[model samples]
Target: MKNYSILSVTCLIFASLLLVLGCKDDTSGQQNAAGQQLAMSLPVVEIPTKTLTAYVTYPASIEGVVNSEVRAKVAGYITDVLVDEGQKVNRGETLFKLETQSLNQDAAAAAANVNAAEVEVEKLKPLVDKNIISEVQLETAKAQLQQAKSSYNSIVANIDYANIKSPVDGYVGDVRLRKGTLVSPTNQTPLTMVSDISQVYAYFSMNEKDYLNFIQNAEGATISQKIEKMPKVNLLLPNDSLFEEQGTIETINSQVDPNTGSISFRAKFDNPSRLLTNGNSGKIQVPKTFEDAVVVPKESTFERQGTTYVYKLDRENMATAASIVITQEIDNLYVVASGLKKGDRIVAKGVSQLRGATEIQPQEIPFDSIAQPIQKVFR
Candidate 1:
C-alpha cells in the first residue's frame, strides 16, 4: 500500500509540470505576433502625376438679349387682334389695331379748314401781284394757310399711330389685350412682351475673393486681354444635364455690389433652337485645368478635426500618417497642392484598422485598381 501511494504522488507531480510548460508555450506564441507580426495587410499604390480638371459651379439667371414691352402709342379700344401669342414676328409687324372712327372724323374736319385757307391764299396772291392790297395783307393770309396745313398733317399722324407694331424681331409673349380692350401708351399694363431668344445671357455673381483669384490667374496683362483668353464655360440645366452649347464670357460689371460684396458676370450662349428663354435658371460650370498635378484617391484618406490625413508607407513598410494640402477636387480624388510628391507610396485601402507607425504587410497594386474599383466605376 505504501509503494502504490508513492507512485500516485510521482505521477501527479509530473502532470503539473507538463501543464505549466504547455501554458508557457502558448503565451510565447501570442507574444511573437505582437509588434513582430504585421497589424494589417492592405493594398498600397504610388501617387500619380497627371493633368486634371476641376469644375466650379455657380447658380445663374438667364435672360434674352432683347426683352421689350409692347405698348400702344394712342388711347383707343382694340378693334382687331392681329398676332397670336408665341408667334414669330418681324420688326414693325402689326400686332393690334385700335379703333380709328373718331380719328377719321377729326381728320375730315381738318381737311375742310385747309381747303378754305387755300382759297383765301389764292385770292390774296392775285391782289398782291396787282398791288391792290398791301403786301403785308397777303403775307398774313399766307401765315394763316400754313397754320391750317399743320393742323391737317397732325391729324393724319395720329391716324397712323392707331396700328400697334412689334418694335423688334422676336417671339411674342402673353397677349393681355383683346378686341374691345382699351389701351394707351401710359397704361399701367402692357399689351404683351417680345423676346428675341436667338441667344441668351446668363447672369451670375462671384464673391470678391473669388473675383480677385480669377483675374490674377488669367493669362493676360489687361482686363480685355484676360476676357478674350478666358475659356468657355459650360451650362448645367435645371435637370442636371449639360447644355449642348457652351457659352463665352461677355462682360463683367465694373463695380461690385457694396451690400453683397459680389461682382456680376454675364455669359452669352447661342440658342439656335430657341430652347432657352427669359427667366430660365441654370448653373454655370467654370473649368480649371491643372498640369502635372499630384493626385491621391479619396478612399485612402480620413479626416481628423477638419484636417485630412492619409497613411503613407515608410521604408520599412510601416504606416505613417501624412497631412496633405488639397488645391482642387475631382470625382473621388484630390489634387494635392503640397505635403506629398510624385512616386510616394501610400496604403490604398483598409486604413480604418491601422494607426501611425504600425507595421503592415503591403500588397502592391495599381493605383487605378485601388482608387477606381472596376465594379464601381464601370458599372
Candidate 2:
C-alpha cells in the first residue's frame, strides 16, 4: 500500500507542473495578441512629392526717390509764412512772402527812369534828324533807354522772387526758419522742405556679384520692370511695425559707390495714403531661381547637436527620424535641400515624443490639415 501512495504523489506533482507551464504559455500568447492589436491601430502618413520655389532674402532700407531741399532764392526777411509743417503744397504755390518794401521802391524808380528815357530818346531822335542836336546826343539817349530797360527787368525779377513758392507739389517737412528771419541768396538757411511722397524712393546696395547677375539678366530692362515680375516689397517702419503699402524697384545708380563696395539700387512706391515715409528702415523681398526642393512643415523639424532633422513615418506605421539639409524658408515651410526623398512618408506631427528609429503607431494626419494655419498662405 505504501508503494502505491508514492507513485500517486509523483503523478500529482507532474500534473501540477504541466498546469504551471500552460498558464505561462497562455499569458505569453495574450501579451503577443495585445501588442499586435496596438500596432495595427497606430497611425501612419504617406510621403508627398511637392514642388517648391527657391528664393534669396536680404535686408534693405526705405528711402525717397525724390528728395529736395527748399532754400531761399532771394535776399529778404520772411514776412508771412503761408504753410505749416506736414502741410501739402502744390508746385508754384506761395509758401512764404518776404518783405518787398525795398524791392517795390526800386521797381517804381526803374519804371520812372524807363519812361523818362523813352521820352528823351524820342525828342532827341527828331532833333538829331533836323541837325538841332548832334548824332552823339541821340546815341547817348538810346543807350540810356537800354540801361533803363535792363534795370527794370532786374527789379521785376527781384520782386517776383520775394514771393517764395514751392518747386513741386509735396508734403512740407520741418520749418527750418521762422517768419521774420532775414535770409539772403548766399545764406545757408532753408525755410522748409517739401518732398514728393506720392511716389517715394528706396535705395539699397548689392554686392558686385549680384550687380553682375542683375545686369546680365536685366539687359535693356528697367529695374522697375524687372521687379514687377516679383512679389511686392515689404516695408518696416520706424515704430518696428510693417507698412501695408507695397513698393516696386525704381532705378539703379549709374555707378557703384566706391566707398561701400556695392552697387546702389532704388525702389519706388505709391504713397497716396501717406502711410510710407522717408528714412524708414525696412527689408524687401527678391525673387530668385527655382530649384527642385522638398518643403516640410517648420514644426515637424527639430534640432539636435546643431543638426536639423525631421521625423518620417515608415510603411510599417513607425516613426523614423531623418537628417535633412535645410536650404531656405518660406513662411512656415522649410526648403529641404538634401537627406529626404520625394514621396518619403514623413511624420508631420508628434515630433516632441519622437526619436530616431523609434517604434510607434503613426497616425496619418493630412499634411494640409496639420499645416492648415500656414497653408492659408496659398489661399
Best by TM-score: 1
Highest-lDDT candidate: 1
**Candidate 2 lDDT trough over 10 residues, lowest sum:** 38-47
**For each candidate, C-alpha RMSD in Å?**
4.6, 7.8
lDDT of 2 by residue, 223-288 (tens): 556555545565655565666677666666778678977887666777778776566666654555
Score candidate 2 by lDDT. Answer: 0.75
lDDT of each: 0.90, 0.75
lDDT of each residue in 43-72, candidate 1, tens digit only: 999998988777889899999899999888
TM per candidate comes to 0.88, 0.75
